[model samples]
Target: MALVAVVIPTYNESENIGGILNALSSLAGSAGLNIHVLVVDDNSVDGTVEIVEDFGRRTGFVSILRRPGKLGLGSAYVDGFRWCLRNLGDFAVAVEMDADGSHDPAQLPRLVEPILKGEVDVVIGSRYVKGGAWRGGRLSRRIISRGANLLVRLTVGLRVRDATSGYRAISKKVLEQAFSGERSYETGYIFQVETLYQYYLLGARILEVPISFYERAGGKSKLGPGELVSFAAWCFRQLAGRISGRVI
Candidate 1:
């Protein structure tokens, strides 16, 4: 069986980590998937690491990398991908997901199947696609999310509908090429856009699998005004780079 490493970057998510791990465990067992979860934590003081440690001890399916401080999400995932590549060398797929219960663990199979079948190099659990729905976000938040995605699509000419969606899976080749040598420009949520844009530039086959995205059931949201500003700046930079004939 091909191993799948689910890289979940977390911060202060003690309440939700256990449930997310448990759901993944159940899904892996029922589906007979060789799924290993790598939880990259940013020194969450909320006992998030303790929960993951306990769960890891119990199931032995989850392992964690504890950082010294709360680094940005992009760096967290990059670290996770590097760890997976070095540690679980046989893992064929790497999945990027949230630890705050916004992304349903049940939809993992839908996100991963395409890559396993070689149908696409990346699979996005998209909220803007058909059969997908966004639930529990406030009107302003919804507008910001939609507007940001649209702006990226127009500016970068990215083909994916939900460029900001983090619920996605990538094949090993895609992961290595996406993170090879260069660091992501946006450190926070905007990293999502940067990663997807890199994949698009690499000419990876990308597919969107419709998914229902719920608001976080516990803990605080990581998105903030700073991330929004960073996103806008990154978009403009990409536009400028494109105009200058420098492929970003």
Candidate 2:
């Protein structure tokens, strides 16, 4: 059985958490998977935690980690990864997915298959690959997403087509190495890029699979101007480090 732990970071996602969890629950009996849904919430006032609790009660496979206050996205994921590494014994794969419906739970198996077969240590659900397609969202948003990915590939030296994509699968071995030390990983939306780069630095075998990226089912995106600024600053910082012989 594939002992997979999915870590979903949520903040006021009451409108969509159920669907996300439900979709994941459906993956329970597939490929003899013993899947654990770890929903890490940042004290949402919108009853997001309540929904998670409800699901956890109904389906014994679900669990949650409640945070004190509104932490950044990067921190939420970092905390979740640490929790899984520390708690989930025999943890085989750790998945990074969005609470929004944009990331299809159906792709979970595809994302982790490479890891299971030892073809790769990390698997990324990509939108720029041959069979990948990104739908909805504003034209500007699409363009900006593409541009940001281009910048990360050039500056961070990560070869992923979708560096900003949240849908990913990482093996327990990779997770142990990623958090084995005190890493000052970014704690914002830029967390996606930083983690991807770290995996690359570790020389992990990485594979990209096609995914249909859709708009969210409900709720609004939490991205803001501050996140945009932080992302640019992070890219520049990494570029500067490379130029200064920081060796990634």
Put down candidate 2 lDDT per residue, 30-126, tens digits, no spaces. 5557899899999999999999998899888888999999889999988998888888888799999999888998888899888988889999999
RMSD of 1: 1.2
Looking at candidate 1, the ten consecutive residues that score lowest on lDDT are 178-187
Regions more than 4 Å wrong, model 2: none
Question: Model 1 scores what on Cα lDDT?
Answer: 0.90
lDDT of 1 by residue, 35-98 (tens): 9999999999999999999999988999999999988998899899989888998988999999
Superposed Cα deviation of residue 66, candidate 2 (Å): 0.6
lDDT of 2 at 245: 87
lDDT of the structure predicted as candidate 2: 0.89
Off by over 4 Å in 1: 180-185
Candidate 1 TM-score to native:
0.97
